[model samples]
Target: MAAQASGDLSLVGISKEFETFTAVHPLDLEVPAGSFFALLGPSGCGKTTTLRMVAGLEEPTTGKILIGDQDITDTKAFRRNVNTVFQSYALFPHMTVLENVAFGLKRRGDKDAVAKAKESLELVQLGAVAKKKPAQLSGGMQQRVALARAIVNRPDVLLLDEPLGALDLKLRRQMQIELKRIQSEVGLTFIHVTHDQEEAMTMADSIAVMNAGRIEQQGDPASLYEHPKSVFVANFLGQSNLLRASIEGPGAEGTVMVSSHGQRLEADASHIPEGAREIWLGVRPEKLRLGEGGGPNRLHGVVADASFTGVATQYLVRLPWDQEITVVQQNDGSARALEGENVTVSWASHHGFVLDAAEPADAGLGHEDG
Candidate 1:
């Protein structure tokens, strides 16, 4: 096993290419040391390729990989102090939990292998399962075992490749918390790769949203969700009701006035693309309220569909322009609208965002649901 080294992961112009096409484009990124960072994108978006390059499994076609100030571009996979926990877990069925976790440490002839493995298992809350075989454990437990195996090595960076993907939703959410806790306790930098938006936002301290083998945006989860600079980032990170609008210049309190579907709407001026007159007025489903709720921005629409999802009611409002927008209202026993009723959707000026209309509004739609 490799020894520990505390260092930020820097990918300077890092890229990957295959015989047919480039898997990853020239990329520059810095994953802060001891932060939970996520490479979030759809399948085949080159996130996995980028992760493999950092683990020294895939040689980069260009640029260098560094841990802190040390250049590890030429290092071998086994020599780099980076460990990967994959979705498959891959624990040996024949070995006990402790044996599985201790295998790597023992292979390196570490004298405290058992003790280290025990501590790692306990860190993952699996200390009691040390004597149990892999087959006796649940899927989530198996995932934890795999994590313990990697953590025992004390790698400077822990790479999780959809490690919780195999479990059910409830279990997966549970593991997200566990993973974050383990990372906090261990204080090791974690680079997680997954396509699930919620998974990345829930566990990551910072997120890099990737598309077409390139970084579209990178920031804290709330910043990316609230102030998305690109249409793809706005739509892909969360559900957005983007309506084509023509900017009517500035508004009061630094907001932008825009006209859409014969109605005037206001958006955050700071979110408006610089010098972009034509824009898409964007609002989240949760940001909209049914009926005229005293917000500056309002749209008259027919309730095309409504679905009750326990605590919230999701309404699909069909605007006069024949476009459908979603509105999620809390079930607080208020007078909710029916499917066929005509209503006005209203939201605060600050709740709306603006994106460049030059790009397709539907961009990142298919990838998000898949």
Candidate 2:
């Protein structure tokens, strides 16, 4: 048995429901102390609802919310040892950075409110801007001020609700790195909620991919991406080319052989669920190699489209089954396939994953391609 987590955030059978809508199903999750955890999914996936329950903003219809061993299900929002930083920044325009950071400490009647706030500001590298009002700071600076304000309280768990959504693409990336650095320095448990796959994978120590009020999968970013158990996870977390196939018994070295459009493909047997006859073969776009090159699995297709994307080139290949698959190859200035050209795609067996076809495959896939 796994050791019981201490000083960590744990949700036990927590769930939420409206009059007729079940926003969140029963969920049991644990965020390890001092680790960066993320609740990742698209809009209305109940990720935010789950966060709200933990924050004590929304009471769960059933079960308990615990910080370590203390049950906080009925605790008031203000009484819980948690803080949330939202995307809006929500800094007071009239208050200087120091005052904003000191607000929580002042309310709690801390004698060293100003000193503690200043230290928090320095923690976020914003002590130089202590005298500036929120209006005088840039968007990113304002964000930092908001962060300083939250962390100044030294909460057990810090909740971030799309905290970088307001920033531009470049600034968002910068904040992702900055947030990870700050989380490490403080050794605080951070539960970040975001819809962006890159943001979750880049910053979180573990990620829970929520969909339709349930957690489809939860694990370290690399494990979830490399060995997704569900089709939704395979496509939602990253780009995947899913091919319909049927199991044809075992192949060399304990690998499973599956047939797709009269072509045999080999995949790691462990990825094929027991007793699953028909499955969707999954391979990441970057995993595929163009022009065969004697790889284990091969598929011939016509290049429907091709585009150079600086570091890599993307090709849309239409297979014989009329499914369009994406292939990405590094731009080494090598020979490239043109539109309407016939090309062979291949990849090593281990790179492939198999998912049960009976499971729903339409859970928020193809957003990038669309």
Candidate 3:
């Protein structure tokens, strides 16, 4: 079977409301053709609602959804050139894997359904198990079957709503790689909705972090991780040590001075958010290095706790201001800190990220006034 021509997806001022409750605020978003896009957020943050709107399963309260040049907001679910894979595999219990994969094509009156299904099964590495029933397959195999069933139809866009949620941790990780590989080989536009940060980061070409019916940040995973604009994004996407500090204006050689608890630190001014005064200086735990001296961006603290993980050592340091900061260093077999010893934490100026101190107006502020 020929592959479906991929199309870019567009949501223009889309919003959803349930009587007095608003699930999604007015939003505009775009997914490029043949790109792996992820809508990442916690539960009730409207990621699923937005996906359902794209799938035509939930009607948008306002605005239009488009696929390339065609308006699909009001189109019926089955009439649109799109397919959805839910968390549940939803395979037919009694039907063989091949039959289940070919069912959609058969219903559409395609004469070569079985042959196409076999090809899809091979794409997902389940061609040998085509004769097995859903009950006979493992959770991972059943998921591959489900994916085969969806991709067999060769839809213009594929919507995945936490399809790997049912798999175990190891299986989930494996499927994440599998799914990305399949998507790349097929060149399909895949819009994935997931609450798992790791899953989104691992699979998506680009990600939009949603919270309280709004997008807190959107970019490639590295960009978002290295420079988060808001506190919600800094804390949500990964573990960040956010220190309350006031910008003491510009420093020498393109650096900005930040004062926290009488200690002055310098950060790359280019990375600081525009118009931010009192800011939260963010540094990933893994970016911090432990030593015993004052430096450009340094903090002196006492080692409160330390844990030895296989890949690295995790340290909890108590600062003079009665606050704790976490640090992670690679297990390079160097001098380690004792629990009661005082230590200095240091990082390069370029590694620091500055975020606005004030929370977003709608962040945990509830729904907008009607």
Candidate 4:
């Protein structure tokens, strides 16, 4: 798989509407040349719709799209230099893998279409199965054929809409790495759409988190995970215990004193408004230390439940206000606490993130509008 020269992609105030329902809100995004970017959200978050508009498959109700400085908003799907690997793989069952891969090149009337198709099949490591129909291949192999078909034309951008959605868990994990490798080899700007947070975190250089047709946050995975901007982002990105807190007074480093479950805790809040009295504090389960801890934020709780995973143990601790906080502990030689045991949970002050208390717009699940 020879890498294609990189190209830039831009979406400016793009929006899509079907009758009275707005499937995608006006949004702007810029994907740098050769970057592996992901649009991540639960189903119905408009990630797919946004991807469709960028691929020229769906006309935006407003705004413009650009590929390598070329205005492509009004361009037809076939005219644009972009290819999409749909969720369904969409391979022609009757056509052999070789012919299916060669289909796009045949339409372009390329003289070396058949040879190029063979080369692409080899790139995807599917040349050995070239003579077999899609029905004869495994789901992963079929997906590879679909990928070969799309890349055989060597488009400027490759849009992957849940390309690994059909595979089983183990296969999906394997395909994530494969997809990343292929994207790197192709050097095409890969814009992937997926609802799986772990998938997005593993493969993307940057992620755009969408909610209810609007982008909630966009950043590198580390930044998004460490400093989520809203409650929705904090909860959606991974498991986190959200605790209701009331700001009390000024504290160290421009932080404010907050009270939660009758315990006073200090946290940095230079970014938060001074007079704002109430906020939701987000603490990752892994950040919480169990038993008598020596951290900045400490609290007493009773173990409500415990579950043992292969590598770690999960404990649900009940607080004074009936709030449940989850804690994850590595499975080491240390004795694991049983359910109904009294325990103290603690974490560093820096580990907590304060989010505004508000219900985000409902983002539905999976290709509803499309």
**What TM-score do all the candidates reach, one by one?**
0.97, 0.96, 0.95, 0.92
Highest lDDT, which number? Answer: 1
The reply for model 3, stretches above 4 Å from the true place, is 1-4, 292-295, 360-370
Q: Model 4 clash pairs?
A: 43-364, 43-365, 43-366, 44-364
Question: Per-residue lDDT of 13-65 in model 2, one digit per residue for the tens?
Answer: 99999998999999999888889999998888899999999999998999998
User: Model 4: C-alpha RMSD to truth?
Assistant: 2.8
Displacement of the residue 66 alpha carbon in candidate 4, Å: 0.4
Instruction: Identify the runs in model 1 with alpha carbons over 4 angstroms from their true place.
Output: 1-5, 368-370
- Residue pair clashes in candidate 3: none
TM accuracy, model 4? 0.92
Q: Encode model 1's per-residue lDDT on 94-139: one tens digit a residue.
A: 9999999999999999999999999999999999989999999999
TM-score, candidate number 1: 0.97
Candidate No. with top TM-score: 1
User: Model 1 Cα displacement at 165 (Å)?
Assistant: 1.5
Candidate 4: Cα lDDT at 224: 94
Worst 10 residues of 2 by lDDT: 1-10
Better of 2 and 3 by lDDT: 2
* Whole-model lDDT values for every prediction: 0.91, 0.90, 0.88, 0.85
Per-candidate count of clashing residue pairs (backbone under 3 Å): 0, 0, 0, 4
Whole-model lDDT, model 2: 0.90
